[model samples]
Target chain A: MVEQALENAIPGDWRVNERLKEAAIYSLAAGGKRLRPIFVLAAAEAVHGDEKAASLAMPFAVAVEMVHTYSLIHDDLPAMDNDDYRRGIPTNHKVFGEATAILAGDGLLTHAFYVASEAAAIGVPAERTLAVVRDLARLAGFPGMVGGQADDMEGAQGITSIDQLEHIHLHKTSDLIAFSLRAGGHAAGATDRQLEALARFGTNVGLAFQIQDDILDITGDQDKLGKPVGSDERQGKVTYPYLIGLEQSRRRVEELTEQAISAVRSAELADSGRLEQIAMRLISRDN
Target chain B: MVEQALENAIPGDWRVNERLKEAAIYSLAAGGKRLRPIFVLAAAEAVHGDEKAASLAMPFAVAVEMVHTYSLIHDDLPAMDNDDYRRGIPTNHKVFGEATAILAGDGLLTHAFYVASEAAAIGVPAERTLAVVRDLARLAGFPGMVGGQADDMEGAQGITSIDQLEHIHLHKTSDLIAFSLRAGGHAAGATDRQLEALARFGTNVGLAFQIQDDILDITGDQDKLGKPVGSDERQGKVTYPYLIGLEQSRRRVEELTEQAISAVRSAELADSGRLEQIAMRLISRDN
Candidate 1:
């Protein structure tokens, strides 16, 4: 369902330009776990707001995923991490050239809000949609993703402390992921208590997910991971595995994942079991 | 007023990060004509909307200018136009390093929507703000500015036809300008006919503006224009002066400017004369 929702999110219009659309759709279709969108749906379901609210959250789900995908595309730019491939295919810049790849990222970033703002038209309250738009923009923007990126780039080849790493990871990885759950809760009109639980859930899950990613970068099969492995060590960037030993990093991932599950479960959410499944799937996934 | 508004628009907090804010503010303060925001304000004023309504439009005006400025910053990137000097000073990337520059552009673009979405919190109706947000996302997004940037890059060394040049200009140069007008009119609650006129008015003025820009590249005084001259010829990209000769291009600029003025006049707008001043100032101004 999430995959279908994402597929349907790209507008079938020539006006956005044929090639530009192709560039955007290309990275989007080059799939990830679709974890972010599913987070939205499960949180919305767990909140047990109006059943129809799940329909409204779809756009937010898609918007979060688009922002995530665009970030990956930009992250892969030659001016950036310079990765040559992603999700088992050529990176966007490799396929479409640097200029188009840059613009494709710009297009996706801009389109995310365009999709989010539409939530009001579909029965979500205007204020609710407005709040969600603000949330995504901030998370995907400077104070969140961009800030982390700037700090990470500035710290290249010499990150010394775990605190610094967490600062980077929190903004770079966790903000948007956390926003997915918070925004889903918002769309579902979740109570403050439920929303708080989801925010904690999102943060812990995001931290765990990043550790799993670091672990995967070190140990996962190239075919399964899609992109090349060992990029962190190759680039000499610091990560959890590098800082605390691989064994410790694996333990940390399990601990964070368990806490992430606990946050949602102790809230006694109506759909607690399903939300736990999401947390487990995210942490234990091979890719 | 617009300058002050823009200054106030930058959030005064460490959350945005000091260096990141510096990068964004550096280019914004480097300054251009500030024409886009001015266009927005003038259109809003011409519509004779409520006085408080002008306050509502200020955010949009600021938002539009940020988007415009961000585009200029990204356009100056080494990966894109590869220009060094802008407004007679070092480009963002040249001063901030490539990664910071890229993140700065990302910061500005994302901040734009953040600022624009706040239009509702003040006094503008939520629906109206949503419409303006959508308009910007589309016009500045892939189908609009990014699409044009991609095409312009693709055709840079080999633009063959006038049609192709116009296609580039329409998206690259005109869409955002036109959007400024329509959005301003929207904030003022202009009638449909008036909005249509503003749209046409924007297109003509934008085309004229581009011709003037091309002309300036050839004939502009180096100190006055701030950047080096003859870049079009240097890069071997086609432009109005290159295609039609300076005299013909000058004539075309005048023709388009007049048509732009005539568009609003024919619409029998509430304050056509004020609108005329904007068009004339845009067409006739020298750096």
Candidate 2:
């Protein structure tokens, strides 16, 4: 269902420039694991067991995926990470050129709010919908993801400890992941306590996820990872393994994943099974 | 008042990265006419005719200005227009590196919605606030400003007539201007008729504003216009004065300004004088 909504997020036909839509659709359609959107859905289902209630969270689900995709597109720009490949395909800028790619990223980021606002039309209360929009922006904007990116770029030159590296990982990865879970909870009318639990679960899982990514960049097969793996080392990017060594990074992922699972189980959710399953799955996944 | 709000829009002492904040503040403080924000305030005052109600629209006013600034910052990037100067100062990318400039623009764009959502706290209904979010995104995203930008870049090569040039101008400039007016009307709880009138007023004034900008690019003084003027011709951009003669373009600006003034008068606003006066002022302005 989330897949279909994403496929149709930007209409194929509109009065505006077709190329802009084409470029936006290009990156959004270049599939990731769709993990963020799945996190949104799982968090929603954890709060409200009924299928219809969980479905009410569809717009938020699609919205997060759009944000994630946009960040990747911009992150891969020639002026940023300068990656030519993402998700086993050419990056948006590689295909459409830098100017259109930048605008495509802008379009997707702006349109994500439009998609999130549709939650109101889908029977989600306006207050909750507004809060979700606030969460999305606050967690994804300057004080969160973008700030983390800036720090990652500048702080790489001055890094001396794991604590500072964790700071970057928390904002760059955990904040948006936490926001996804919180938005799902908001859509399902989850209590403040329940939302807090989901945030904890998301944060732990997100940190674990990033650690696993760093480990994979050092050890995984390039074909399975679907892109060049050792680029982190080439770019002098500080990662979990780079600071703490591979053994410690793997141990950290295990501890974080366990904490994430425990948070979901104690949340008093309608169905904590999916959240727990996803958490456990993250720790063992090869991709 | 709006100046104070824009100046303080991004907090100085945030826990996140400071460079991102500085780069965003650099372009924002360089200053334009603050026309979009004023349109928002004027529309709100026109509807409610009270200082308190107009103040409720302050967040939206700041939000539009932030969006405008972000667009300019991105537009000035090395991959985009590649300009080194804006408002007689170095562009964001020129001062900050390309990567930081891109993230700063991303940060501002995302934070604009955060600022707009503050309206709910200021007493605008949640439903109205949600509508404003939708309007802002739809107008500023692919269907509006971004799409127009993409079209402008690609269409410049194919533009052969005045109509095509106007199509680009209307979307690139007019849509956000229309959104600013509509958002203010929304803040004041204007009826559908009032909102429609504001839309018409914004659309006309926005088009007139673009035409005047094109004329100034050709005939205005270098110091007053800020940044170089003839770059439009150098870049082979299509303009109102290019396809239609300069005299015809001047006449078109007069016609649109008259239409905009008439829109405010017919709306039965409590104080149409300000809106009308601003529209009239556009025609004689040198800058």
Candidate 3:
């Protein structure tokens, strides 16, 4: 159902420049769980808003995915991660060449916000739309995702503590997820109290998601994971699983998951059933 | 005077967060011509508008500079341009280290749009504000600057035709300038015809600016240039000077300057003296 909704939301005009259309489609269609947009839609509905309230978050959802894809493209560059495979296919730089990959990443990143701003133009109230923009910018910009990425790059080449690893993941992966929830709430005219609750929920869930990822990196099957296991260790990178033993990491995940679930319940949202299911699925994923 | 203006514009309280503030200050303080913001101001004034009219354009101007700086930082990366110096000092990655440099660039790039949206909350008419946002996105996004950067990256490694080089410059350099002018006009309530004229002016002047850069790269004193003489050739990078020869490039610059000046004059703007002078100075620049 979610996949069908995403397909319908995506613009399907073939009359646009084929190369750009193809590139945009290729990057987006390369699958991952569409968790960010789902969070957005769910948050809106939970607040007694319609799917149209999710419209403000739609371009942003696609945009967040673009930013994620771009990061993957650049990370896979020979100078960076040097990984040849991602999601079971050759990474963008490998297929498109380094220069194109760099540009492709850049293109997607800039276009994400541009596309997202369509919300304001399309009748989301000015203040509400601006809030969404602010949320996205703060989450994605220097103090957040970019800063986290820098920390990760440094940590990869040097020794880092578990706390530091948490900091890195909080910004790099979790901030955007948090923004997804908050942006959806803003679109739906959520109260400040509700927004704060959602923010808390997103933050905890994001950290849990990263911890699960680290655990999966060590324990999951290569085929299901779509990349080699132990690449972090091979690259001398530190992760939650590396700093804390596997058992502790599992315990931490459980704690975070509970925290996330509690935050959602505290918000007293009407339609949080789906979000609860999502949180459970995220924490319990094997791959 | 310009420095004072900028000082007034930026928040004074930014120093509270020491590290993040330092990073932000370091990048913002690293001085350039401030061409983008000046264009925003001048374009607004030329349309019989005031600074308030161009407030939306201010963040965009700052954002454009951030994007420009990011490109420079990335271009100077070891895997890319590998320049050791910029603006008479060590390049960003050199002073800050590659990891921090990368983050700084990413930070500035993302923050640019965040800054631009300030006008949205401050009550710029929704239509006008959206127009500014859209223009910035288009100029800075894939089809514009990033596209140009891609072309430059490809052209750097091998031979490229003069037309391809022009395309690169047009996208890489010219589009933003065009955006600057158009955004200013939009802010100041310029008529569609007036904005169109300024766009023409921007395009011609932008091309001229690149030609002058090419000329400076080839013929200017290394000490004054602050980098190196013949760096383009050293990198095997194709540029205007490389394709058309210095004499033809100079001629093209003059032609473009004249055309730009004429366009600005033809617009019958209320105040275009500064704009015209800036264009003339740009073409006449020796470094």
Number of the predicted model whose DockQ against the real structure is largest: 2
Candidate 2: residue B201 lDDT (0-100): 96
Model 3 spans > 4 angstroms off: A1-27, A49-52, A155-162, A228-237, A241-244, A268-270, B1-28, B49-57, B121-123, B155-162, B218-223, B227-248
Residue A30 lDDT (model 1): 92
- Location of the lowest summed lDDT over 10 successive residues in candidate 3 chain B: B13-22
lDDT of each: 0.84, 0.90, 0.73
Shares of reference contacts reproduced by the candidates, in order, are 0.70, 0.92, 0.44
What's the DockQ for every one of the candidates? 0.67, 0.87, 0.39
Model 1 TM-score is: 0.93
Better of 1 and 3 by lDDT: 1
lDDT of 2 by residue, A44-92 (tens): 9889986666688889999999899899999999888898887778899
Q: Write the per-residue lDDT of candidate 3 for residues B5-114, one digit (tens) a residue.
A: 44443346322223443554565677888787778777877886445555545655666666776777777777666778768777776777654665566666677777
lDDT tens digits, residues A1-287, model 3? 44553354334531223344355456556778878878877787777545666655566566667667666776677766677776777777666665566567667777777767777766667667666766776788766787677667766657557776787788888988888888778777788988988888888899999888888988988888877888777766677878888999999998988888888788877667777888998887877
**lDDT at B55 for candidate 1?**
72
TM-score of each: 0.93, 0.97, 0.87
For model 1, report DockQ: 0.67
